[model samples]
Target chain A: MKEIWTITRRELQAYFDSLMAYILLILFLGFSGFFTWIYGSDIFFVKQANLQVFFSIAYWTLFFFIPALTMRLLSEENRSGTIELLLTKPISEWQVIVAKFLAALLLIVAALALTTPYYITVSSLGNIDNGAVFSGYLALILVSGMYIAIGLFTSSITNNQIVAYLLALSIGIFFQIIFQMLSSNLTGIAGGVTDYLSINSHFESMTRGVIDSRDLIYFLSVIVLGLVFSESMLMKKRSV
Target chain B: MDIVIENMTKTYGRQKAVDNISLQVKTGEILGFLGPNGAGKTTTMKAITSFLIPDSGKIFIGNISVNDNPQEAKKNIGYLPENNPLYEDMPVIDYLQFCARIEGIAKDKINDKVREVIQTCGISREKHKKISELSKGYKQRVGLAQALIHDPEVLILDEPTTGLDPNQIIEIRELIKKIGKEKTVILSSHILAEVEATCDRIVIIKKGKIVADGTVEELRSQAQGNETLKVTIEDGGLDEIFKALQLLNTVELVDFVDKSTQTFQVKSKPGQSSRRDVFNLCVEKGWTLTQLTFIETRLEDIFYELTLDN
Candidate 1:
């Protein structure tokens, strides 16, 4: 745990020490605010105090934002050759992976926390279901976690950050939108499998203001699978 | 701690980066690993440091297997890998502290330990600056400082002085020498003179195999298996010296070099000197001997002879 914290602390500091973090935070909040209030569906236009517009906009904003934030986690280290320096320490590969995951997750949480004013504004406007608002944020965190893991795995596979970003985005799109589209349009087992594979269906369920075990299991399973694949990719580098 | 490796080999798609090789470095020994550009020096160092796994070999640091319990073995080693990759965004002090923490140094002693290494590596002034803001020499010092903060029993440095100016190289070499008095150091360098001056023993590799291993003089003798001597004679005719040089049984070949000097390349039998016979011959011929110097086969010559063809 000490070793993992050592890595995590340094990585977290690195994120704040650079301009990337500030840029990401601004872009995430700016896009979320713009899409939710001005362009997509304003509270006045919807005639309700619900934050569904913000949550809906966040889904797309997070897709690009999470990948940008995570694409450099391992890929930059590999490109700069610091991965070798880091891995050769007494710490294990699993520890490095876990530390990086926690660091990126913390940054994402901070970004999400900054969006709290939107919820406060919605509450001030009219009566709003607090449970649904809480669930909406919870669903955002789960989906963001899933995407971050996928980004980390793709980052581990390649040393180029741009390549990692594109690869992760491509794979994430399959689960984010393609599967959702296919599942709704197709029928029978194919549609059922696509629906099960798509993360949006699970996220949609969570956004309905109730927590379900199946949706939680689905997100958790994706997180575990992504982390496991990332760990295996890093371990394979040791042999080759 | 002592490091022992046996039958270590690592291959990449049929190309062996580190072929079967065995070596041992006792405690407090400085082993200079010398090789050509692609001779697998980095690969071997990585395998020993637990950064890479060997295909068919075993590495033990203080009797703990590097292939098995790497965490325990890694605690004994501090490696400054080639290119000295560091977090450019981090301050030198923070980077060292990070390394000390990862190396499991006690929290209470982290500050003092970082101080000691910063002083030892002569990077105290640069400690507060970001790594990317420092010059190459100070960057290298930060690299060394990071490796030393834990005070590990073994230190592995790959091309530690590759890019430094003359003064910085000497400084780092002096630092390594001071540290080598207490720790086992395995450093690879293309600078033969630096290695010859600093390392107590050298292991020269070519094509992923060790071609030469010994002290400077021992390896020199092993390279040519004979000695060449340059004789500068004054007040003596070249023809007289040439004719008289053949009379000595120890003198193998005498070639006229210039007006009065001639180079006598000789192969002495074990534990014998051809100069003794040459001195006597000069005395007998009433010739004046101005200078006599042996042409020692340098590490550069041996490195080229071993690595040039392949």
Candidate 2:
């Protein structure tokens, strides 16, 4: 646990030192503000209190930004040969994986937090349900967590940062889009399973102003599966 | 504080990176691992440090089996890889402190320990600067400082002096010698002269196998012979020098190293010194010898002779 925290602290410090956190925050705020105030406002033609615009825009933004943030978590270490130094320390494989995941998760959470002004603007402009907004943010966190896990897993398989980024984006898009399409094409039990596998379905359910236990389980399972695969890859490399 | 490696092997796909190799390092002893490129030197070092596990073998670090409990076994090791990967954005002191934290050093002692290692590695002056801003020698020192921050019983360094100037290389060699007096050190290098100058014993690996293991004297004796003689004569023609030194029956081979200065390296029979014969030959030829010196067979000959067969 101590070792995990040490790694986490270093990783977080790296994000801040490189100005990555600041850039991510600015990008998140700029996009969310443009979508909500400029496009979704009454003056722009699309007037809706549904917040569907915010969710859709935020989700799409993360499809590219999350991979950019996490593509170097493990891949850069391997390319620069720091993985050997880290492995030589007195820490377990799981500790390293969890530490890196937690660090990336925290960065995404901070970026999400920057969207608070958007919520405030929506509230001041008209009547808004605080509970629904809170639930929406919660769903976004879960979705971001799932995306970060996929990015980490992709980063573990290769040392090239560009390859890691592209692979993560492809996998995230597959889970978010293809699974939903497959669910519509199939019927009965097969369709139900496909819908359950679709990340968008679970996230969409949570953003509808209700917290479902099933959606929480789906996101948590994705997180665990991604971390488990990452740990196994590291172990296999070490044992070679 | 002994490391015992028995029949260690590691394969990458169909290629065996580390073949069945075994060796031992006693307490407070420096063992230089000498090998050419792709000779499995780095692979074996990684196995000892538990960064890479062997396919089939047992590595015991102070009686602790690394395969069974790698984390526990690794606590006793401090490894410095060839290309030391440091966080370029962080200051040197901060990086060492981070290393101390991962090693589980107490918070109160971390500061003093980091400082101590920085001083030991001769990087105290550059500790305040970011690693990216430091020179290559300074960066190497930072790597060495981190390796020593935890004060592990075993230190494994792979090509510690790979890209450094002559002065920096000498400084690092002296530092390694000083540190080896108190800790078990295993350093790998292709530079045979550096290994000969710093290590107490050597293990030469070639083509993923141990070709020779012994002290410098033993390796030299096992090679052709331990005796060598160097004679530098005044400016003379090569044909005259060759004719002058070729008359001795005891001289096995007279090698002319340079023609301008007429320097010749004469190899005598095994266990025999050719200084007396060369002196007599010089006297008979009426050659005015400007300089005559005896040279011992160094590790380079042994390394080349052993690896040449492969």
TM-score winner among the candidates?
Answer: 1
Label model 2 with its docking quality class: medium
Which candidate number would show the highest lDDT if scored against the true structure? Answer: 1
Q: Evaluate candidate 1 and give its CAPRI docking class based on DockQ.
A: high
Q: Would you list the C-alpha lDDT of every candidate in the order shown?
A: 0.88, 0.86
- Model 1 per-residue lDDT at B37: 91
List of clashing residue pairs for candidate 1: none
List residue ranges in candidate 2 displaced over 4 A.
A41-53, A117-131, B226-295
Q: Give per-residue CA lDDT, model 1, range B275-306, as digits (tens).
A: 88878777877878777888788789988898
User: Ten consecutive residues with minimal summed lDDT in candidate 2 chain A?
Assistant: A41-50
DockQ (CA atoms), all models: 0.89, 0.70
Taking the tens digit of each residue's C-alpha lDDT, what string does model 2 give over B187-288?
A: 999888899999999999888899999998888778855366788866456788787677676777888887778888877777777788777766777777
Question: For candidate 1, what is the DockQ?
Answer: 0.89
Candidate 1 has a TM-score of: 0.96
